[model samples]
Target: MRVVIVGAGEVGSNIAASLADSHDVVVVDVDPDRVEELNYSLDVLAIHGDGAAIETLEEADAGSADLLIASTDHDETNLATCGTSKVLGDAFTIARVKHVGFLRTWERSSGAFGVDFMVCSNLLTAEDIVQIIGLPAAVDVEWFANGLVQMAEFEIGPESHLVGQTVQEADQFDLLTFAAILRNGDVELPRGDSTLDAGDRIVVIGPPERVYQFATTASPNDAATDTENVFVVGGGEIGFQTARLLQERGIKPRLIEEDPDRAREVAETLSDTLVFQFDATDTEALERENFGAADTVVAALDSDQENLLVSLLAKRLGVNQTIAVVETGEYRDVFEAVGVDVAVNPRVVTAEEITRITREETTEKLTFIEDDRAEVIEVEVDEKSALAGEMIRESIPRLPKGVVVGAIAREQELVSPRGDTVIEVGDHVVLFVDERVAEEVTSSV
Candidate 1:
């Protein structure tokens, strides 16, 4: 498929790179240097011009394109670019808007701008953070259909009561299903006989209330043998964000901040939380706070080194679990090497979400595999979809090679879909596919 991507910035470039592997991608950027950089770095066509201009879209042969993605930093430019692309290409057009309000108000009328989709980075990023915050038990959470369906990630701990049980046994609650397992960053299609070991990150899907109950039940084991106290290192935005999230969940978080004034400000803002004005790198100060007694320790400091150090120190001091926030992508390996249970990078998370939305053909980012060979995607079954109105078993042969339906979301409920399962219009079907056949499966559906 011919695709036109506007803006060659981080988000735009990532989206273009992701799609270029499977589709014909034409990237447009105002900066000649950026265009040249992208051209040298990836196998994508580059056009250096104003993406918001109709002339530029024409030059890129937008009219014949299958998809147009506008992902500029400015909300207005992105909207205008999408509008222009829709006029020129008359194809599936998506825009990345900054303000959440723009997304809420954009398509108020039938005759509004012909954008097929609108992605609000701020809203998406905020929602990603909020979901993690709201469900502190899960390392990550994905919501479907206005929060009716939820996918959650949890790590199995040594003392977890459900460690010996299989997915089917643990999920006998009748509402939840173990969707996938992330073992050392690899997605595993766990069967009924598969046993969950300590440190394995398992993904579960179910309704909101059922997911909540599972999270609550699993957290006590994952977090620690018992929950008594919490310690957070850093006074930065991430630190405050993490602290606020923990506090809201009734887990009182004690933060250790190096900057006295910043610590005071955070303390004032979150009076309910205990803010210790001390250097996180100072082991003595951390020890004074009885870090050993803390159930879990979180490192959200500005410097990745400090965060890693704090996490290592917490772990060494007998903390059951340690989570840190790492900014640099290169430091991810180091986070794991230091025995950190979870290390979150906001930029990487945000970039992935943005790219998922921008390059979406039929499905969203489902699951990542270890060998980078397969993935799971959630696709909205359109009226023209091959799977629509067809029984799951009947449609298997028609589906693209290396792809199989894993689950289905219909009417805000998750169904462990089988061959007899019939797909309806608007149902979001989840499929597991090898990377090579992703586009084929998506386009076919």
Candidate 2:
């Protein structure tokens, strides 16, 4: 498929990299440097021009493209690009925006902005943060099989009981499967002989209950409990959405905004939330508010530097968990290394979501793990598929290495996959595939 991506920023570049291997990708940007860098680094066409302009679209041959994605940081530009693409070409359009109002408007009316699909980065990031907060100990979480199956990543600490145990020894959960392990920045499929180590990020999939039970074992700190005192910094869209969602889940989080008007606005909008008109980075304010007793502190400030500082301060002040919204992917590692518990990148999340949507139609869901080194994909077993009416032991061996059957959903019932389990037609099959052989796994399964 020939795909045209507007905006050569982090989201656009990452999407181009993901689609370049399997499809024809063309990227447009106003910065010549970005275009030059993309042209030199990726196997895609990079045009230096205004993406919303008709001449630029014509230069990129957008009329014959299979898909056009607008991912600029500006919501108006993205919407305009999609609208222009719709008017000039027959390509399916996707617009990436950060405003929830736009999503609501598009939902109320189909193709409101001439977009076949829309991705809201702020909402996606907030939802991700909410998921992490809901399931403690999990750095990342994804659902599949219509929410029947859950896949989560947990970092093993030195105190974990399974730190030195092999996969076979750690197989205590009856319904959970050890999907993959990330050690030393490499992704590995856990086998009977594979041993888990401290600092290893392990991916597991199973029913929600089973996964929650296993989470406690993986990280004892994630034991189920009520988060009574939650602190949220920033009253921006991401922070507001997060606080609102948490409130809906019975959590009354205190939000801090430096701007008085913004704080007042949020306080009025959120009845359950307590909004403070003060600088979150102020030590005196944090101390006065008893931030030390906070169960969780989420830094959703506008600037990455400020968020990093807030998270670091929260940790120093004895907050149990600190989550920071870092826009740059490179800073995620830096944030984690500097004591930030979880780093949420809105751009990366948006890019991954868009890529999943653009993948094969048969793919019901796709989630990246181990920093895109591996993936968990959900596909339905149809009559023509190779997995139909086959036992796990017989069919799994036929697939490439590093690909494992994680779970199965048959008629709304969750099934933990095993050697004797038979995969029948109409069942939803979840598979863990290494990035190196993702295409092969997708085609075969």
Candidate 3:
């Protein structure tokens, strides 16, 4: 498939990189530096021009492209880019916008703004934050196989019970698979003798209940508070949406906003949420509210530095979990490294969501781990699948080396992927694949 992407920023670059290996990709950016960077770094054609302009699309040969993605930071520019692409080709148009109002408008009319699909970054980011809050010890969480299979990444803190345990000793859950151990930014395929470390992030896949059990076992102290008491430190759209989502689930969350006007506005909007106008970085205010005893505290400030400071403060005050919204993808690791439990990047989430649409038929669910260093994908075995009629041991050897068959769902039942287990057609399989071999594994598995 030929794909034309607009705005060569993080989101556009991410989408292009993911699709460049499998499809014809052309990136359009107003910045000459970004276009030049793409030309030298990726296997895609880079054009310098405003993508919302018709002449720019024509120069990029958008008329023959299979898909057109508008991923600029500005909402109107993205919508305009999609509309312009429609005039040039019948390509499926996707627009990435940060406001939920545009998504609501698009949903009301099927092809509003000439966009075939729309992604709301704020809403997506809020959903990501809420999911992390749901799983106490998890830095990331994804569900697959119609919610039967689960994928989670947990950071093993110094207080965790499993910090010093070996993979063999920690293998108490029969239905779970220790997919990969991430230590010091390196992905390690675990052996029975691999020992868990305090700062290591362990990726696991299994049934939802079993994964939840493992999470509790790994961080017993973190899981003790549950999801009852929650605190949100921002009045931005993402924080408001997160509080609203928690309210929907019957959990009233307290929110702190520095700006008095924004705090009043959110207070009026969220009936269940308690909005307080105060600087979250103020140690005295947090203590007065008993924030230390809360089960979870989400730092969603606009500035990355402020969010980092607030997250660390919450951790020092004894908050069970601290999840922060990181605008820049590069700051994610830094935040997590400095004691933030989970760093949610809106751009990364949007890019992954858009890339997901390009490969929807190949996988039921997909999520990028550690900023696209690895991926956990759930795919079904069809008649054309390479591993359809072979045993687990026989088929795995034929695939790429990084592939690990985590679990299988057959007829609504969890099938443990043993060496001798036979993988029949129509069975859904969850696999952890290194990013280097992901494209090959996705095609052949």
Q: Backbone clashes per model, in order?
A: 0, 0, 0
lDDT of 2 by residue, 104-162 (tens): 99999889888889999999999998888746667898888888898999888788888
Q: What would the per-residue lDDT of candidate 3 be over residues 1-445, giving only the tens digit for each residue?
A: 9999999999999999988988999999999999999999999999999999999999999999899999999999999999988888899999999999999999999999999999999999998888778586798998889988889998887888898899999999988999999987799999999999988899999998898889988888766657889999999999999999999989999999999999999999999999999999888998999999888999988999999999999999998889999998889888987888889999999999998888887888888988788999989999889879999899999998988899999999999998899999999999999999998888887
Give the poorly placed runs of model 2, Cα more than 4 Å off.
222-225
Greater TM-score among 1 and 3 belongs to 3
lDDT head-to-head 1 vs 3, winner: 3
Best by lDDT: 3
What is the C-alpha lDDT profile of model 1 across 1-445, one tens digit per residue? Answer: 8889888876677677677787789999999999999999898999999998999999999999988888777878887887887777577887776665677787675424567777665444334544554343567677654555666777676666667877777776555667667676666667788887877777776677777777666665443243347787787766676677766767777888888899999999997789999777777877787887776677877688887888888878887667677766667667866577666655455446655664455665554333234555777888989999999879867766566565677886677666687899989876666667766777778
Candidate 3 is scored at a TM of 0.96
- Give the local distance difference test score of model 2: 0.90
